[model samples]
Target: MSKPLRALDEAALVLFSGGQDSATCLAWALARFGRVETLGFDYGQRHAVELDCRETLREGLRKQNPLWKERLGMDHTLALGALGDISETALTRNAEITMEKDGLPNTFVPGRNIIFLTFAAALAARRGIRHIVTGVCETDYSGYPDCRDDTIKAVQVALNLGMDSRYVLHTPLMWIDKAETWKLAEELGGPALVSLINQESHTCYLGDRGTMHPWGHGCGECPACALRRAGWEEYVAEKARA
Candidate 1:
C-alpha cells in the first residue's frame, strides 16, 4: 500500500491561480497541512479577469472560515511576468485556443509552470517551509507538455538539488483526471471547493462572464471548455449514481 503523507508541520505553499484545478488543490492543501499560503501569477494571459476572481475567492475563504485562516495559516501573493507580450502561445496571443491539433497546443506557455513552481519553491524555502503544492495534471490537461507528471518529477528533483533542501513538491492532481479532481473536492466536504469552482474560477481566454456556459467562462467550444464539460458530466453522473 502507498504510504500516508508524512505529518506535515510546515506551511504548504500552493501555486494557486483561483481556477478549478488549483482551487481543488487549495482545498486539499488546507486539509492536509498545518498552514497554506497561496501564490498567483499575473503572467499576462488573455484572461486577466481570473486574477480578480482569485482575489474574491481568497477573500471569501478568509471571511467564511476565519478559524481556518488563523489556525491553518492562509495567505496569497501575486507574481507578475510579461508572458503575454513575450509568448506567442494562444493563451497569451490573440490566436484561438483549440484542441484539433496534436502535441502541445498554442496555449502552452513554454516554461510557465516551471517558472511558477520555481518561484513558489523559493518562497517556501525562504519561509522555512518545505512543501510546495501545485495543481498541474497530465490526465486532463490542455495538451500542455509542461503539465506532465514527468515534468513535475523532474522539477521536484531540480528544486531539491538546487536549493539543497528537503523540499517536497506536491501534485495532488497529477495522476487523476478532471472528474477525479472534482471528486477530491467533494471529499473535502465544503462549499469552499464546489462553490468557488462554480462561481469564482476563470478558465476562459475571452473572459466571458456569462452563466450560459456550463462550466463557467469562455466559449464552451474550446478545448479547455470541452475538458471542463466532460469532467463536470462525470462528476454529476458519479454523484447521482452514488
Candidate 2:
C-alpha cells in the first residue's frame, strides 16, 4: 500500500458496519488518510451481531500496523430502528431470503445507503471530518440500486450542496468484484488484514456465526455467504496460480 498522503486535517469517516465490504473500506481509508474514524448504524438488522464485530476488527486492525493504530480514530453507532419499522425486507425481519418478483433480492432495504451516508455526513460535519468512505459495490451484486456508482456520485453532490462543505465520498470497492475485494484487503494490510477479515467480520444475512467456513463464519446458505465463499475460493485459486 502507498504511504499515507492526506494529512490529519483531511481525515475520513468510514461507514463501517463490521461486514466484509465495510471492513475493507475502513482499511482502505486507514492506509491513505492520516486519520480515519468509523460509523455504524443499528437499523435493527437481523445481523445486528455485526455491530459487536466492530470492536474485534478495530482492535485487530490497530495491532496489524502501528501506522494504522496512530491513524484510527473514534467509532460511533446510531440507532435507526425507524428504518426497520417501515421495511419488511429479509434483512430487517425473519422473512425468507429470496429473489423477489421485482427482480431484486428481498435483502434490499429501501434508502439504506442513502440514509447511512446522510447520517455519516452529519456526523462528519460535527466531528470535522472532510471525507466519507463506504463499501457499496455494484460488481458482485446488482440487486440494490443504492449501491450503484451513479447513486454514490449523486449523493456526494447532494451532500456537498446541502451541507455547504466539500465532502468527498470514496467508494474503494465500487468496480471490484468480491474476489477482488479479498485481494484488496490483502494488498492494503497483508496477511494480518486477510486473517482479521476472515475471522472477525460478519456478513451473513441470517446472522449465523456458529459454523465457520474457509472464507469466514456464516450460514453458508445466504447470498452473502455464497458470495464471500466464492470470492475467497477464486482469490485463493488465483494466488495458487501465481
Candidate 3:
C-alpha cells in the first residue's frame, strides 16, 4: 500500500460510473483529495440507467453532506456512446453475454478503461489536477483485461509520457474484492454513506433495479450482480465474526 496522501487543497478527478464500485471510489477520493471532480461516460452501455443513478447519487450526496458540493466539484458526463456503434459487446449489445475470443466475457468493452482514463487525464490536465481516481477492481473483476493492475500501470506510464504530464492514476479498489469495497465505504464515511450507495448505485448489466439482493439491487444472474452479492455476503459474515 502507498503512504496516505495528505496534500491539503489538492484536486482529484474520479471516473464515476454510479455503480457500487465507482460510488465507493467517489467517497474514497473525496475523503483523501482536497477537491474532487467526477467524470461519467455515456458509452452506449446496456444499463443506461446508471447514468441517471450517477446524477441522483451525486445530488443525494451533496444534499446529505452540505459541504460535499464544494469539496466535490461538478460531475461531467462524456458522450462516448458512439463506441457502441463500432463494438458488438454484450454491454453495448442486447445479445446474451458469453465468452468471446481470449476467454473474456462479451460484456467487456474493448479499451474502455483506456479511453476513459485518457480522456480523464486530458480533462485533469486542463484543470491543473494530477490525481485521477477510478474504481476498477481485479480481485473480482470478472475477466476484463483492462481492469488488471499491470494494464493500469502501463496505461499510466503511456498517459504521462504521451501527454507530457505527471498524472497519478489512483485505483483504490484495485486489489480489494467487493466485500472490502463495502468496508472501504464504511471507513470513508459511515453506515449512512454505505446505505446511500446500496440504494442509489447501479451495477446490473441487465438494468434490472427491481430485484433487490443482499449486496444491491440488480438482476441476480448477471456476473456483476453475482460478484456484488457474494462480496456483500462476505462482508456481512466478516462483520458478524468481528
Most accurate candidate by lDDT: 2
Model 1 lDDT per residue over 1-242, tens place: 14446445657888878678887777777777777888888877777777778767666666656544653454556555665567887777778765435666677778898988888888887777888889998878776788888999899899899989888888888889988887887776464567667677877666666754555666776677778888888988987999
Report the lDDT tens digits of candidate 2 across residue range 7-37. 5557999999999999999998888888899
- Candidate 2 achieves a global lDDT of 0.92
Question: Between which residue pairs do clashes occur in model 2?
Answer: none
Tens digits of per-residue lDDT, candidate 3, 1-242, equal 56767555789999998999999888877777778999999988999999889888887777766557668887788999778788888899999978767878889888899999999998898888999999987888887889999999999999999999889999999988888999988887788888899888999999998887767799898888888889889988999999
Candidate 3 global TM-score: 0.95
Best by TM-score: 2
- Model 2 — which ten-residue stretch has the worst lDDT? 1-10
* lDDT of all predictions: 0.75, 0.92, 0.87
How high is the lDDT of residue 183 in model 2?
A: 96
**Each candidate: RMSD to true structure?**
2.3, 1.8, 1.4
| Candidate 3 lDDT score at position 145 | 85
Models sorted by lDDT, best on top = 2, 3, 1
lDDT of 2 at 81: 99
Off by over 4 Å in 1: 1-8, 63-67, 71-74, 99-102
